[model samples]
Target: MPRITVAEQAGVGLDGAPRPSEDVVLVRPDAVIVLDGATSLRPELPSGGWYAHRLAGQLAEELAAHPDAALPDLLAGAIGTLAAAAGLTPGHSPSSTVALLRWTADRVDALVLGDSPVVAFGPDGPRVLADDRLAAVPRRGGGYRDRLRSGTGYGAGHLRALRAGGAAMDRLRNREGGFWIAEADPRAGHRARTARWPRSAVREVLMTTDGVSCAVDDYGIFPDWPAVLRHSVDKGLLSVLEMVRAAERTDPHGIRWPRPKPHDDQALVHVDFTEIPK
Candidate 1:
């Protein structure tokens, strides 16, 4: 059996608030898991981390027990578990983006629920696996949520906004939009992004929340991913925390940007998939 190497990090953004946890994993044969929680300013919804922890723990178990289950089925099961564990009425409860990558000798299977992204790079180039509505929003000025809130609620108007959101997402993020996981709402619909990996010449794999993905614009598709992954491996979760701290140093609401988006929490998990045994 080939061994697997994994790393994760969480940090406060330039705004000085805690970022949400956004990475989750269920590595089979060699299990590795990362879960990220979304941070919210609303005092009424304080359990983003709690929700992520519970969902990741339970989902990891379910995936471990039945590694062969369908991706959608697995997600449905996880969602049910989350709703029950958090006592969330489908109407209430903080929702999160979920991404899982499980691989075997010949295939790599991935699943994504929200805007959090999953990206893969290899000898060929970069390819995106799972993308969500949030991917479309302009990340430069906190347009991701700003655009979401500007739309009509969850009906047809909301779906239109989401579609419009993607069109608005500029692929200028350095390496282009390789796959990355992002935060999302459950009511957002079934348009999940998924893929099976090709082992030949594959070099790297990354699963990150919007915080890191948003920064990808700074690096492009492959960006400084290898360094970022290595940093996470060396510094552990705190490495990501530091990145969030760096983003926080900018002050989202500072005079630098005139009007600024509310500071949001962030988490990122970077892995050298090639480093994981095939």
Candidate 2:
């Protein structure tokens, strides 16, 4: 019973070459699904974007076949199914963030894994449902930030530092005390943060990959979450993404905001809960 509008843009590589977005947004009859795949650094392993595309399809199928199934079970099953088919290994495989929002007759449910967030807005203002574990875990290597602060832009040294950081994180992935993500491991799904609310209490729900979220989360493109919702509903979600891209263009060297790249693939979905289920 909600009206959903979706927006997406493929990000450019460091060289400004157009690349396919790893983020995926899938809509089931009663659910909204979003995923942000981690960029792959190793040439031996399939890219994270490839993994995300297949996993999204599998998860969509599982959700459609079992409408009343638990979210965690569905997620685990989907991940396991995909991994088996792809012959993916636990530590060697690619991973993705997961966000889901579903509505039933009386209530709505939301889930978040990795950094992608699911936000619900209503009379209580905004309730942000996000998984902060990945951020909480300190990175093993981040010398690039130091180098950038010292006046070096996104050069070869910066890329080497980036690869080192990714390799460090890979060592800790899916392990106890490390953050969980939707990778070859099925248990990560069970680790997803989940929340439920009365359908009447929710007026709108916003789901996004960190690309769009960086506007508030990092870019400060908007003042806050409520402002994001206002602008999205007024101008459209695509407009919000354009603002983010504009900001990225201004800070091409990662000086203004030290990030892995100039831009990341973005996906956003805004769901209005006023309409009846068709």
Which candidate has the top score in lDDT? 2
- Worst lDDT run of 10 residues, candidate 1, spans 173-182
- Per-residue lDDT of candidate 2, residues 1-278 (tens digit): 57999999999665557888899998987999899988887778898789888988998999888888888889999999999999998998989999988889799989898888998999989999989898888854347777766668877887788778888888778888888999999998899999999999999989999999999988888988899999998999999999999999988778878887778999989999976567
Q: How does model 2 fare in lDDT?
A: 0.88
TM, every model: 0.63, 0.96
Model 1 clash number: 40
Q: Which residue pairs in model 2 clash with each other?
A: none
lDDT of 2 at 90: 95
lDDT of 1 by residue, 157-255 (tens): 433443344334323211234222222223222345667776564556677665566555432322555555555566764565556546545644333
For residue 124, model 2's alpha carbon misses the true position, in angstroms, by 1.1
Candidate 1: what lDDT?
0.52
